[model samples]
Target chain A: MDHGEKRLMDKNQESLFVRLIPFFERYGILLLILIMIAVLHLLQPDVFLSWRNVTNIFKQVSWQSMLALGVFMVIVTAGIDLSVGSIIMLSLMGLAIASKAGMPWYVVMLVAPAIGFLCGMFNGIGITLLRMPHPFIMTLGTLYIFRGIGNLISGGVPITGFAEQIRVIGNGKIKLDVFFGEGAREYIPTSLILMIVIFFIFWVFLNHTRIGKWIYAIGGNPGAARAAGINVDRILIVVYTLCGFLAGIGGLILAGRTNSAYPNAGLQSELDAIAAVIIGGASFFGGRGTVLGVFAGVMIMGILRNGLNLMNVSVFWQQVLIGSIIILAVYIDVLRRQLATRT
Target chain B: MSDNLVLEAKSVSKFFGTITALQNVDLHLNKGEVLGVVGDNGAGKSTLMKVLSGLYKPSEGSLFFDKEKVTLNSPRDSQNLGLEMVYQDLALAGNLPIGDNIFLGREPTRKVGPFNFLDHKKRKQLTEEHLAKLKINVKSADQKVEELSGGQRQAVAIARATAFNAKIVLMDEPTAALAVKEVGKVLDLILNLKKLGVSVIVISHRMDDIFTVCDRVMALFQGTNFAESELKNTSRDEVIGWIMGKKD
Candidate 1:
């Protein structure tokens, strides 16, 4: 009788552990971030846990997160924007031209995303009207075309001394440190605030809007969406345009932070955005991505980079690790799709 | 040109380059009627359905809706005339929920001054009402299409067509992929569509399905209309023979 009771207790304990495994699976990556932070804190006890370092990471990831979110939408439609990084350069040129022409800071900000919208619109038209087979081809061509255009126009020169408003936008901090008590000297970044606000907007746009659901539908089965009377061409155009628009916003932030518009800005940043989206539990197979998952992905990438830098890791090793993670994430996505279809 | 006729195809022919996919096929469906189209493989049943759905323009002939001479330039033109089609593939987004699939393109919206948002509450309520009317045994309106059985998916497709008040619903091979146990549920959904006063054109190869739910059966053999008659006047053996290219 005593043995039976003991066995029952053991069974109950096993069941509890089994239930916790799902939690681990769901948030195992998050746990990994914490472990990484712990290790980093141990390595750089003074600097890693400092508020300055933490805020710097947030500020750095703010613009890239915008790119990640934008690419997330494009990917949700089973499309890619290889030109996003290149578009950033193009938008930066637009920003420089507008500012140099003595335009208002707000106009300067508008100039970047506006150029992005047009470029994205062109990408959409090329993919749809040109009868291109896939977005991959269309975006690939524009990637080089945009970069070339930026270089031609800017002549490879960098423009600095943006308006005070723009500088604040990129690097200005709101003094919320007083809330932490006297002499805390902590200030929240404007870019970080803007990034979070945009994230909220994107979440609502994807989950609550009609076009958002249509995007998912098109990704899941374009033929079905077309059969259902959706204007598929228009939606694809909208997605590409939105991606371009967001990349422009990133450029705006970039200009503010560096106080300069350089032709080579955001070189290869599109790869980073793609990597972030893939790691965020989104599938390349389309119709399977979440904003929250992508936010986590952005955080993971940002934290990893920050941690590695504090450890004084080589830039090449960082690239190697990020590349490996991208492959691993995609492989996991493929396995997940296989498992989903089997049931 | 009777007032009772909802749709009529007058000697329709479809050619693919040098190959004749359909040759001079004539068909008609009445108000609140279930027409079963039967044929052997490569007999152009799909071609006929596509022509009717306006996915393919008939190479030679005219289409009439409500006895008015009309031309179907595209699927939108047909849909605008209260015509809807549920393809053999069902054309449903498996990742989406039932409500989203039911109202994919024509999602109703609640406009706030300048901004328009999907009226999700209204959508869910209508989806539930339609599913309830069809007596579909899905867990909820929010259930994803991938999670449903083949029968449930078929019911969802029919529900989508009927929800739009489509006067004519064209279905292609509704039961071809369904299991024996699930076939009856699909057939019952078709009956429910009929009971709702909706007209349906069901294309199938199964004689049992035809006799069970369809009021009339038409056969296509080698890209031509071979035979057509009321189900009561025809035997299953005769329809089977008609399917096998045996002439009477």
Candidate 2:
């Protein structure tokens, strides 16, 4: 088709809603949270809009956002990592065990994520070298294997009593003074600051780098990418390793926040992170996703949980609700893809 | 066809689990010759080119470049030897810009160390200069290769190979999917490459293309060479008949 004809046809093929749907999908969760808060403000402004609820929401999502960023990388390559939760558990166990044995705080923090990196490398080697059918299957196997190992190490009980200095990364915040006013204080977490910095760095890595382009290209059409001479296996390995390392860091924060590390800690956390990524519009088929979209996704999940808590929703029903939301979001994604291909 | 030969494949054979894809296929392309291989589907024209381009290694026989026998283990091996292939699919990442796709694996880097970054401006200028030298009408280096027409994308692929200093190019039906005008553009490109002294082994079933541009024509049938002759001496009907496996 000529340029003019093609442009006309594209416009005719699209409606305002159809064009907006992709944009909405990227930020739909954030928009939903805003709308929900608006509704809550109309109903019970005092309790729902309180500073305590706001801080609680940020605290809850601080670690999950980090997990989402890792998942974002994997999903862009059209791979699934079910082993993040297990990797987190394994990292936490390593950190707690090492710290209990008199390892230095810096040494524990740095060495903990390396354990996760090794797990990712293990998954990468298995998946790429063996040519598994899907990363989902490969990582699912590792998920159970790593969790079992975590169980064997911890003996099926939560590891507790970390060094006081190590816990400060999770529990302590830089105390803000004089900025608000005399005697006014606003605490900002080291973990949350770290998340923002990591997010910014990862955003640049995915968008502004050649390696990031390779990841998307591989996800889009691996055969074509290989023909173009990209080392798909190497890139996949790096992606999984980064995912493992992030999960490790998140697990450290989780351990510090709760003052304990359980074998079942971060159980099903992979599902939450994956859901957030997909909800943010990263596809299972690969080749398209963004950190910004995922940041919005974590925000949506955080707001949903926080809003429910403020509204006195029970924990059991909250799980059901979140599960239903995840299913609905994925179904919508599948439908959108179907509609896209049909056109 | 020349006193100094650039590439020759001697008695190359390939098998796919008892299915002979190519058998004892001997072919030669001297420097600056547009050697055309014409055959019907399943006649091993593509298989021969793939073997030459190192997409597949011959199970039997030897390949020589510049009178030196060599083993090409992979496409990278072929690339290092200044040999490149432009497959029917073009081997481009459509989602990426033309510049990025052209320099897909070997992107220019600047700033070094931890703060290293892609030298986008330098890459763009180099790509534009290269494309311009080829007389390939590209709208912009930043445009996605997919946004270009079939013929323009082909030109981009050819331009990229030339930029990489390829001495031998293997193009498989470069004009098969293009429009009539686009076909003319690709024909012009082949002639242009011939002028630049790049030896090309072009595989196509199109009689007109072979007769128009090829200095020599090689006909294949059922995984083997049926006839090989200079275009000045070979008749179109004779080559077509030989391509159909007619002995007499």
Candidate 3:
């Protein structure tokens, strides 16, 4: 190529790079996650690449994934549900008490989710009808209230002796015997399957449903949403309620996995779930995120913890690393938004 | 002409905790007429519009639409009665696509079994059709509102108001932030709405737009009707005098 032609091509490439900057900012987390996986595999190939360990990671993160999904919706509406962890603990406590009362296992399952829905409704009502200035304060208040109730009910002890059927919901695995030879079985945790199914349902809802669009619209600009004839208060209530309901489901899975419902179960879980959602790509300021992005986010956290554990990294160091990643994720989001506005 | 009046407000007053935003204001809008509302910053132009659009209920007095007495409790109530407002802020969700913003609350949906899903194809087609009919020069319906220029965002907001079959459209400072050329486009849009026989109540500080588009001008001075006259009968100086509380 001639010198002028080469310079012209270089200018075109430069412009193209500028154009792709926003795209990179958006999916950079996914890339970082892939790089982390590669690095972990390089560090401990035998342990990290094992299917058994991979499935274990998925099982470990499934309940947290559920909580993240719920938090994702709430964040998308420009709200936060700080009460999620407490709601989960409270729901599990209700399940434990019900099971101890000799209620049928199926009935307890139904009751647990019902308790969760009501708790969510309480948050919703407190914010919507009471006209709370911000959901942060509302949910934060409920967080303490619900946790206090949980502690009171459980008397600061664990509730055990759950039925085997109930236990299977968390610990059971679906084995693919047909696809593998003897002793080469692949097992998928039931909870993981449930999480995936819930994710799929929410993906369709957020993308294809009117309420989902309203959630984005409200989050993007609530004054506009109201002026456009949307019932902003109603949608906000629905979102917070759903967040609580999902937290209830997470509580049930936790109870099943441990075969007990401890008063302090799911403590500080809200932070992890919020971190996962933010790390996935949802903006803390709201009106931006995708369900797929959230799944990727949950996976990133799962992989990070698992990789660190495999490396025998100290728990303190893991906390520091995860905290740094959260700050990095939010900083990237801020930069992405700035680029978006500029373009 | 009086029989053709589409909306009439009689002695409407709104007070915010002893602060009278609007006091005993009387207004009238005729069919297919562009009525300009001119006022100073605190002259209660926006307050009056809010009452007409049902954002706030009047502290006292009643509204009449199509010669019948009525009450509007909310924006939805006004919208149901074929009245719509293009707020000064434009009220467009920046993150949403043009089509979605245009049909944010009133999206078309298709039912599958017991579930309802957005009919995105229909929405896009209708958005395109509306933009074309209104001659709004935007790239596509799928383009996000944030990506559009100021004039284009205003066009989308206007298109949204018109697409819902509003008989009376109230606009607040529609040309306040537009470039000179873009301001011309918005003025032309108001003319087109008039051609379609839609009544328009435009609140603006730009006297040129009022002269170019409004049929009759209403001036408010400190929340009261300072002057009301036909555009041809009133001059810019006279309107300015009314706004400045120098003449009534």
Scored by DockQ, the top model is: 3
| Ranked candidates (TM-score, high to low) | 3, 1, 2
What TM-score results for chain B in every one of the models?
0.97, 0.95, 0.97
All candidates: CA RMSD in angstroms? 4.0, 4.8, 3.4
Q: Which of the two candidates, 1 or 2, achieves a greater DockQ against the reference?
A: 1
Q: Write the per-residue lDDT of candidate 1 for residues B1-248, one digit (tens) a residue.
A: 26689999999999999999999999999988999999999999999989998999999988999999898889889988999999888899998999999999889899978888899999999999888988888988998898899889988988888788899999998998998999999999889888888889999888878989999999999999999998999999999999899967
Best-fitting candidate, scored by lDDT? 3
The best candidate by TM-score is: 3
- List the candidate 2 regions with Cα displacement exceeding 4 Å: A1-44, A47-51, A314-343, B1-4, B10-24, B55-62, B67-69, B135-140, B145-156, B177-185, B232-235
Comparing 2 and 3 on lDDT, the stronger one: 3
Winner of 1 and 3 under TM-score = 3
Per-model TM-score, in order, reads: 0.90, 0.85, 0.91
Instruction: Provide the clash count, candidate 1.
Output: 0
Segments of candidate 3 deviating more than 4 angstroms: A1-28, B2-4, B10-26, B56-62, B179-181, B222-224
Pairs of residues clashing in candidate 2 = none
* Model 3 per-residue lDDT tens digits across residues A1-343: 8999999999999989977876776677778878988999999989997888998888888888878998999999889999999999999999999999999989988766787889999999999999899999999999999989988988989989798878777888888776786566688788888888999999988999999999999989999998876889899888888888889888888878998998778899999999999889887888989998899899999999999999899999999999999998788678766866774
Model 1 - which docking category? medium
Clashing pairs in 1: none
Question: Candidate 2: TM-score?
Answer: 0.85
